[model samples]
Target: MTDDKSTIGQLPDFDTLANSLIEEGVLTVAPSELHGMLSGQLAAGARFDPDTLLRVVAELMDLDILNGENIKLILLELYQTTLAQLQSTEFSLQLLMPDDVHQLEQRADALGGWCSGFLSGFGLYAARHAKLSEEVTETLHDLAQIAQIAAESEAAGDEDEADLMEVYEYVRMAALLVFTECNPEPDDTDEKQPLLH
Candidate 1:
């Protein structure tokens, strides 16, 4: 457990940005969902290439949303924050999501979108598809199940709150485990610096 928290404090409001994106007809997936996808890729050992990520996001948006300076800056901050947090040695990663002010059902649905984005990002990585490790396979399956979460019209009671909390924790811990499993820390002893004559 790292003492570090996400640079979320320094970023713009999540729901505001998401709404802006929606109004602009930029993307179907929200910013939090997009972050989920990026985090998944980083966990799989992808480099923190902001340009490439922006390009991927633009592709996903169907139209370039970079024309707006605020949007561009927000995205840059998001990528930077996610990279910093996930790269922490203490497995300190948190999902970028709407605040608790939102309804539980809405939050759960957003999480489902986040999971769907995560699976999409995983699919983009050839390594994920090529391997057959049982643990990783099972993790992927679990994520897939969450991705299909549907919203309910009825108000959630105490049980739903408990279930949502469990799911949230599971998703958070699952991401950490997947990241650790895929990208083990490099052994310092294996490095051999070249001797200068």
Candidate 2:
């Protein structure tokens, strides 16, 4: 198995994944939202298995099986890259979204979609847990609100751009917070021992 840290700096970028999806005619979910859904599942302690991940994506996105192989490769890479970023000690998580060249409203819309996907995936698994910490509960509530955000009717000015970045940063950190809380690292010293004769 590859070390999670080894995969840290090698994540596939948003445009590349997005373009590939478009070329393949899979338009059901944006790359950002797909990444968010995977992140949410990982945060909720879902095990990493390529087939299972592909199945979940298909079900969630209403994807057709005939187009599965190529999409499966993309999804697997995304899953590994996301899992690695989450497990890294350096706090290197990055949300998948378009570059700054894109208009603020478009990016904001993607961010909202990402939050929606995260909530969907998180809610699907988080229900198994009897309770969540107060912090996590509040964070989920905040994410839900973010998911509903719509950009202003007027042209976005500098202030709107700055505000959008602030919201983006909050959502990024919120994802990390959820992951950290739900998937605490196991203690090395707590490893199980073999039974003695």
TM-score top scorer: 2
Cα-based lDDT for every prediction: 0.68, 0.76
Writing each residue's lDDT as its tens digit, candidate 2 over 76-162 gives 778877877887787888888888999878888888888888888787778656788999899989998988874332357899888
Model 2's TM-score against the true structure: 0.84
RMSD of 1: 6.6
Per-prediction tally of clashes: 0, 0
Q: Compared with the true structure, what per-residue lDDT tens digits does model 1 show for residues 83-157? A: 566656655567777788888778887788777777776666635445646887788789888867633333677
Top candidate by lDDT: 2
Model 2 ranges with Cα > 4 A deviation? 1-7, 66-70, 150-154, 187-197
Model 1 TM-score?
A: 0.79
